[model samples]
Target: MVTIQLITVKVTAEPSDAVTEGDTVTLTCSVSDVTESMRLVWINSDGKTVVEKTLKEEKQEQGLLQLIIQNADRDRRNWTCVLFHQNIPKVLIPYYLKINMRARILPDIWIITVSSYLFVKLGFAVGLICCLKRMDRISNNRNPPKATGNKETVQLQTLNSDADLRSSNK
Candidate 1:
């Protein structure tokens, strides 16, 4: 006498965590208990069958199924795998396909902030230099240096001594 145990088929998707937007995602469905006859099916969060366009391609191998999602976008919905036994499709495991949006310019938020700060600092420095130069030019233009006549002249230093130091007495 022998007893039979049934109901032990579970399916799981690859990258069982998350996916990034604009990146290709591969959801490979593999069954725990391999059986003689089993079929794989993919369904969306709305329980509707997924279209072929959404799934670029599919591969089947040794009780395993593969699904390719191309151009991953925010519009993508969560998906789950189903296995069919005796032509009756049953629920397997549910996978949450999270399309993570990366930062547009930089991956880290701090890098962008630091770069912005540097650019603003540089701009302020340039503005200050230009302002100072313009002010100096205006001041110089307002005040002109005094000029003497065209005749050549000599500057003589006056002495406080009572005696004259000149060689010829006048």
Candidate 2:
């Protein structure tokens, strides 16, 4: 005669705690009665299987699940630990993952851009002023007062002759 035993599988675990990025966590799942034949399944929020094992594989039905989040900007995911035996579901535990982006720097490139622009504007203004001064000097040399036949030119010549006479007398 063959006999079948009714087994009660009760899985218990420590309450989940908050963890930072790149943290190592140890999750323990224990089944009552059939501790030696229990199987454990770990599933993420998206219903994706992460790990599955039987009690024969490791003692304490424990697993070391490390959270290696490559993209910190992504949303947190839900993790579940399911315990079963003989293809029958026994217990379920849910854990939440919290992820955050570590801000490293603030942009100060605007300050540099504004300063460079102002420097260029000031340099252009100074260059324009210098160019105008040089142009004024060139125009003055190119078009000097003409010696027109007028009273002003006559007075200028009389003064020049008077200076010449005085220099000879001296």
- Highest-lDDT candidate: 1
Question: What is the TM-score (0 to 1) of candidate 2?
Answer: 0.41
Pairs that collide, model 2: none
- TM-score winner among the candidates? 1
Q: After superposing candidate 1, which stretches have Cα over 4 Å from the reference?
A: 1-17, 51-61, 105-170
Worst ten in a row by lDDT for model 1 = 52-61
Give lDDT: candidate 1, residue 164.
Answer: 75
Clashes of 1: 0
